[model samples]
Target: MKIAFYGSSLLSSYWNGAATYYRGILRELAGRGHDIVFYEPDAFDRQQHRDIDPPEWARVVVYDATPEALLRVMDEAADADVVVKASGVGVFDDELIEGVMQRAKPHALRIFWDVDAAATLDEMRSAPAHPIRRALPDLDMVLTYGGGQPVVDAYRGFGARECIPIYNALDPTTHHPVEPDPRFACDLAFLGNRLPDREARVEEFFLKAAALSPEKSFLIGGNGWDSKAMPANVRHRGHVYTAEHNAFNCSPLAVLNVARDSMAHIGFSPATRVFEAAGAAACLITDAWEGIELFLKPDEEVLVARDGQDVAAHLAALTPGRARSIGQAALARVRAEHSYALRGEQVDQILRDRSASITHRQQQMERA
Candidate 1:
């Protein structure tokens, strides 16, 4: 199949959290003999801070953030067997969604892949005229990187033809165990770009935990935290690139996963970092959210914290041996059950089944 995906940057993880998820899923899909072309905008300084060169698995087209550029890309994407307009392109999103529906060849399958489904659903609820809400009925399928059943149910309620949740999984080749680096050495490290919905939670879960454990060294990575107040024991390393993520995970005594407000409330939405850390065999501590057991075993493969106090308590009593054991267990579990290879196969089957059903329906109509 020839797949054309319009999404946030695939070459940069600068301010875009979905870069790795795109790389993982699309790379796997390409490995299975599909031709993939990723379209991303040159905006928000992402092109200036690209982490990797254009990859071999997928051809990336970086377009200007202009109407003309969008139209050019739309025309180029018209011949794809599958056309995907992913949420959060950061530019001309409405036009892109409508373009995917209108510009693709009549036989091409259209998909709206929501990397942040919880927030998208909330927007649809508040604004009935949202592009996704209007496009749902005509789209062949809605695929999400997170939000399990809640997202599926919500999209169906919004009149989607079909909805499926394809949870984040480890891309072992891209993210796995690496030697620790002294530059990122700390007792606990949290890496996430600061966003409105997630800043408060980061304060409560990460900063407060650092305060509670004054003796422990903490490291903060990601952009937009230059002026945020933090405990004296915490060190801020703004904007850690994707290339250093493995070292950042491995060097920390334990790594933290803080879900955005919407994702935590909706549940079943595991951030891409969880699998990245797990693949590197880093001890994982995540804020409490529902449906974690579906991915990793609590108390054995991962540590769940209800609040800052729980995080502090876990860190205080954690032994080096225990952390190592948990990290190893997580690595084993993800390798066995949550690798991108498995996810790619699942997605392949879904696409094949939907295509066959569409063919069958067209044949029946012809007979009539």
Candidate 2:
């Protein structure tokens, strides 16, 4: 199958958190012998701050953020077996959605891939007549990065033909354990870009935890967090590169996963950091969210924290050997069931099954 994906920068994780997920799944698909073309906007300063170059597995099309360039990409995208318009493209998303819906080939399976499903559905609920709402039923499938069953049901309620979540998973090739680097060494570490929805949670789960455990060292890594006031025990490393993520995870005694407001509310939504931390065999402590047991077993594979106090308590109680045990359990779990190869295969199976069902129904009608 030839697949065309339009999303955030594939070669840069600068302000594009979805880069790892996109690359992991698409690269695996390419390995399965599917031809893949990734179309990303040339905006967002991603090109300027790119941490990676185009990989050999897929063809990358970097188009100007102009109407003419988009139209050209849309026309080309329609030629593939599947055309995906991912959410948070960071430029002209509304236009891109409309263009894909209007120009895609009749046989192409059109997908609205929502990386931020909770946020998208929240906006839709407040505005029932949003353009994407109107477009959902016409799409072949609605896929999400997170928000498991609730997101699927919400999209189905909106008249979508089908909806499924392609949850974030570890790419062992990219996120396996590495030797700890002194530069990022700390008692606890949290890595996430500062967005409005996540700021309050970061304070609640990260900074407050740092304050409570004043003697313990903490590290914060991501963009847009430099200006925030922090406790003296916490060090902020603005915009840590993707290449350093493994070391960042390993350097910490335990890594933290703080959910954004919408993700926490939606449950089942795990951040990319969770898998990366687990892959690096970092003892993972996460703020409580519903359906979390589906990913990692609480108190066994990962630790669940209710607040800063809870995080502090967990950190205080954890012995070095116990932390290593928990980290190992998480690593084993992700390695067994949550690799990108497995996710890529699941996607391929979904497409194949959906296609077969349609054909079977057509044949039955013809026979009748």
Candidate 3:
């Protein structure tokens, strides 16, 4: 199958959180003999901070953030077996959604892949004329990186033909245990771009924890946090590139996963960092959210915190041996059950089933 995916940068994790998710799933899909073409707009200085070159597994077309460039990419994607318009492309998102519905060949599978389904669903509900709401009925399927049943049910309520949650998983080849580096060594580290919805949570869960545990070292790595107020024990490394993520994850005695307000409220949406941290055998302490047990075992594989106090308590209680044991357990679990290879196979089956169903329906119409 030839899959044309329109998404945020695949080559850059600068301000885009979905870059690793895209690389993991698409790379696995490509390994299964599918041709993948990724179309990302050159916007938000992402091109200037690319982490990887055009990968061998997928063809990446970086287009200008202009109407003409969008049209050109849309035309190029017309012949694909599957056409995906992902959420948060950061430019011309509505146009791309409409274009997938309007321009793709009738036989092509049209997918609205929502990397941030919780927020997207909220937008659709608030705005009746949202492009995804209008396009839902015509799209063959809606695939989400997270937001399990809540997202599926919400999309169905909006008249989607089908919806599925393809949760984030570890790509062992891309993210795994690496030797700890002194530059990133810390008691706890959190990596996420600064966004309005997530900033408050970051302060509460990360910064507050650091303040409470004054003796422990903490690190923050991501874009847009250079000016954020933090405790003297905390260090901020703005915009750590993807290449250094392994070191960043491995060096920290434990890593943190803070969900955006929408994702936490919606529940069941695991951030990509969770799997990345787990793959690197990093003990993870995550803010409390529903459905985490479905991915990693609580108290054994991961530590769940209800607030900053809980985070501080977890850090205080964690000894080096206990942390190492938890990290290893999480790593083993993800490797056995949540690898991208498993996810890619699930996606392949979904695509095949949907295509066959479409063919069967068409044959019935012909007979009628």
lDDT winner between 1 and 2, please give it.
1
Per residue, candidate 1 scores C-alpha lDDT tens digits across 127-242 of: 98998898888899999988988888989999999999998999998889999999999999999999999999999999999999999999999999989989999999999998
Report backbone clashes per prediction: 0, 0, 1
User: What are the per-residue Cα lDDT tens digits for candidate 3 across 204-284?
Assistant: 999999999999999999988998878999999988888898999999889999999999998898888999999999999
State every prediction's TM-score relative to the real structure. 0.98, 0.96, 0.98
- State each model's CA lDDT, in order: 0.93, 0.91, 0.92
Worst 10 residues of 3 by lDDT: 99-108
lDDT per residue for candidate 2 within 45-90, as digits (tens), equals: 8999887899999999999999899889988876787888999998
In candidate 3, the residue pairs with backbone N, CA or C atoms under 3 Å apart (3 or more residues apart, or in different chains) clash, namely 222-239
Model 3, global lDDT? 0.92
Give the Å shift of residue 217 in candidate 3: 1.1
Give each prediction's root-mean-square deviation over alpha carbons: 0.9, 1.6, 1.0
